[model samples]
Target: MTLMRQETEEIPAAVARLLSSAPETIAPVAAAFRAFDPHVVVTIARGSSDHAAYFLKYAIELVLGLPVASQGPSIASIFGAPMKMGHAAALAVSQSGASADIVAMAKTARAGGALTAALVNTVPSPLADSCAYTLDIAAGEEQAVAATKSYVNSIVAGLSLIAYWANDKPLKTALANLPEQLEKAEALDWSFMLETVSNAQSLYTLGRGPTMAIAAEAALKCKETSVLHAEAYSSAEMLHGPVSLVNRDFPVIAFAARDAAEDSIVEIINGVIPKNPHCYISSDKSADAIQLPFIATGHPLTDALALIVPFYRFVEQLSLHRGLDPDKPAALKKVTVTR
Candidate 1:
């Protein structure tokens, strides 16, 4: 088996480990967040980590009712601008905790008076040092360049932190049950997408709210592992302009979690099925679009997060089917440090 496939299978256990040790690692960060009580939250990350931030952004906004923004690392690393973050809190998500610019931005956020925290797999790395609070995501050594477990664990860490901060029992219960759900998620069959993805040159992924972030991550994984060109769009935004790109030959996968937006997503999928018959959706509510089985995590937020596991499994198989190596994508390293 490929390293990517092995790592993908390991995700359930990784998340379980992270959740089991949450009190020792994540609780302190949650305490800090509760104490700070910032007016706004800003996230610092890139690539898959950035996608995790996007997921957390919706979670923070919907649950805590605090607006979250993505802060550009270049503000400190390139332009060297002084940020006024006195009323803000910063969350930096990194798998390696070694990116130079991410480290710089974390330092800048702390200096600028934001209650800075980091969720990282690498415990003693520079990015962790830069932040006032650091929670190791505890995904273990992720050898695959595509980052299956680390990405999942990063989001899990952030969600756990949020749950502790708000004392949200329901969210906590959902998280406690996430490991079993994730195991089922890993076992799900998404092989139907392999033939379509292998044949197609390009496709679109659609989601709303937290699932939009999952869609973005899915698109990136397609590009990274299979060398396929894929783009992610919000179901709402696709109607505006990108819907013009959808045709009979074009494939679309809409990720609809069991949330307030599920009905709207199903409607969007129904609208697209006429123009593109090769469409798939995660939610079973869609009658026309091909339904992809998903593990419902009870909470809307975690239900979105669970969608990625099967995608990871499918993409790994797709990469191998295309005679490509999922672990070592062309021109991509495991740990990218960009300034």
Candidate 2:
């Protein structure tokens, strides 16, 4: 059994841990958000953590109507440039919480008059030390070079904070039931899409709204573990120039949440069916595309996180099928510190 597979199965328990500890761990962050009430929000992260930030970007903007943006850590880590972030809030995410660039960016956000917080696995690490509040994702120690439980927990932490801050009863209720939903997600089989891409050199992942981050994370995992080149695009964006590459047999995985975007995403997937026969989509609604199984977390936001669990399981198997080790990808490290 590879570490990646082990960690992927641990996602439900990890999420349960984060949820059970939310009252104490996330209360202060929610309180700070209510009190600070910043005009804008900014996120600092890299790689998988950055995809978690993108998920939060959509949640914050859609739920609270506060505009959110991502700040490149290189600005502070390399150029030593100052930013005008007064009256803003910053959210930084890292599993290890030791990246110098992320730490520097968090420090810069604080110095620029922002209320900064972090979601990290290691509670007392440098990035956590630099923030006003740090919520431990509580994913335990992930041994896989490709992150699974940590990424899911990071988004859960962010969504929990958003739920409390916005006082969204539906979202809060959905989050309370998330552990079970995530467990259901783990059992879903995406092997049809896996078999389709098992021999392909490249593929395209499509999604809209918060699930776009799921698509992005899925694409990254394909590259990291399966050694396949996968590109992520919004269902709308893929119709532009990217679809030109799609032939009758080109593989495409569309992540369609059971939210407002579901109909549109299904429509787009149906549109692609003429050009690509290997298109697989995850949604309850049917289309010309192949239907991949998914769990419908009661709330739209939590639905996004649920989709990744099955994908993680699929990617782990796909990697092994491609003669690669999912536990250790090529040219990668567990903790990457960039400055």
lDDT of each: 0.93, 0.92
- Model 2 agreement with the true structure over 36-145: per-residue lDDT tens digits: 99999999999999999999999999999999999999999999999888889999999999999999999999999999999999989999999999999999999999
lDDT of 2 at 323: 92
For residue 145, give model 1's deviation from the true position in Å: 0.4
TM-score of each: 0.99, 0.98
Clashing residue pairs found in predicted model 2: none
Residue-level lDDT tens digits of model 1 in 75-136: 99998988999999999999999999999999999999999999999989999999999899
Give per-candidate clash totals.
0, 0
Q: After the best TM-score superposition of candidate 1, give how far the Cα of residue 299 lies from its true spot, in angstroms.
A: 1.0
